[model samples]
Target: MHRTLLWLLATAALAGSAGPPARTAMPAPPPAVGEAARTGGRPWPVPGTPVVVRTWNPPATPYGPGHRGVDLAAPPGTEIRAVAAGRVTFAGPVAGTGVLTITLDGSGSPPLRTTYEPVRALVRVGERVAAGQLVATVETEEAAPAHCKEEGCLHWGLKRGEVYLNPLALVRGGHARLLPVWGV
Candidate 1:
């Protein structure tokens, strides 16, 4: 499902830059400092570089367990946009990836810190997310994670009711941006 989302998003982006319709609700309050990794820096996510996928669905290994995320070959420090509008539930450090995990503030946090930023939740558990909004910063790391295929890329993922979902389709507010939360 996440792979499909990523493809759909890439197609939409190639076809046109106009993203999906904005969700109803005023803009969220400004995020805290350092909450969002800026567009440019040491570890950029993909600010301008074309979006590329490294592992659509990689096999599981020592890093945690099953494949629960998609790795994008983006330049490190790339600005990772939010797939949907939901408060950030967790953001910090994952063991393997050794980066930050910015999970949305959804139903609940399911201890899935497979990367370096094992379990980093930037936004609070009860905040609001805006489509295409800046959710997490491109990893700010001196050295890219071993799991990262590109020299400076990130393994983005999403979830729906505990189900691991794709991260791309939701990029730049693709179909994944239409998700409804809090009865909104």
Candidate 2:
């Protein structure tokens, strides 16, 4: 009877000593990209509102032929600014053309990356740039192949992972909203 009593006490003590059950820690989700856009208003990369020489034309397939980005008509030597705050991931020449890419901060997993080409980079790679901050200047005709032929243009691109997205959507306040219709 004493042994049974002692075993019961020991079991009770062990159970009482043990604290609440352990919980597995879950990683916090990343901030939404739209929230970042709201905090950082959409700003034109070029001075004023430059004409869009070519609009974004997404391809049917990843390897399909299509314009991956938009071409903004800006003369050579024209200053180019960042459309959003991000860290410069690439700032150098690619395919004989000066290219600059910025990976947006707090834009979720595999963050959105913005690309600008045919521009002489004023900011180097790994640099943190604010929205509307000057990052480069339009590359001269002699420096690289003009995307818009004789007239120079800055090709702006946005990508999340390998999928290309419309950069103008950023400028146009992202997704379109629907209006309520009244019954007549």
Candidate 3:
């Protein structure tokens, strides 16, 4: 008796159904906060709009192979500027190449550090630098090995402790946002 009643209910439910449920459109979420939003508008380290020879390519694992920074095409002796106000944490050579690092002010815990390599240091460690201030000049080929084979390039990097971030985000105010496909 219970089996017969169950069968009747199942038959009635299926008979009332037309087909599978239709999918409804949902609103796209807002863009995530980026470095530019957190640090305000930071300027590009290189003068003018330098051509990007290489973009940031993060590693899959901590020890994985990846380009930790972006490479901007600049000629030898091109002036380099500070992207944000901060103190110079390191200004010296690393493996025969001149390197300069600045710890950004008010960038939160651990703070954000910006680094430029193959640059002759103009600011010393512990020196407070303001945004857009000249910090260093790109090293000549004779001073250091060429980073880019075709032309001299400045390797710019940004990190919060051990995590590497896209440096371009600092200049652009954030990453590019994609629009919804349905025009929402």
What are the candidates' C-alpha RMSDs?
Answer: 11.9, 21.4, 18.3
RMSD of model 2, in Å? 21.4
TM-scores for the candidates: 0.46, 0.71, 0.70
lDDT of 1 by residue, 43-107 (tens): 22234433444433423353644445555555544555554344455554444343443344332
Q: Give the poorly placed runs of model 3, Cα more than 4 Å off.
A: 1-40, 142-147, 174-184
Cα lDDT tens digits for candidate 3, 90-130:
99999888999999987766677999988999999999998
Q: What's the residue-level lDDT of 36 in candidate 2?
A: 39
TM-score of 3: 0.70
lDDT of each: 0.42, 0.71, 0.71
Q: Which of the two, 1 or 3, has more TM-score? A: 3
Q: What shift in Å separates residue 134 of candidate 2 from its native position after superposition?
A: 0.6
| lDDT by residue (tens digit), candidate 2, 12-57 | 3332222222222212211333443565556777776467777666
Of 2 and 3, the candidate ahead on TM-score is 2
Best by TM-score: 2
Give residue 73's lDDT in candidate 3 (0 to 100): 75
Top-down lDDT ranking: 3, 2, 1
Q: Model 1: how far is 78 from its true place, Å?
A: 2.2
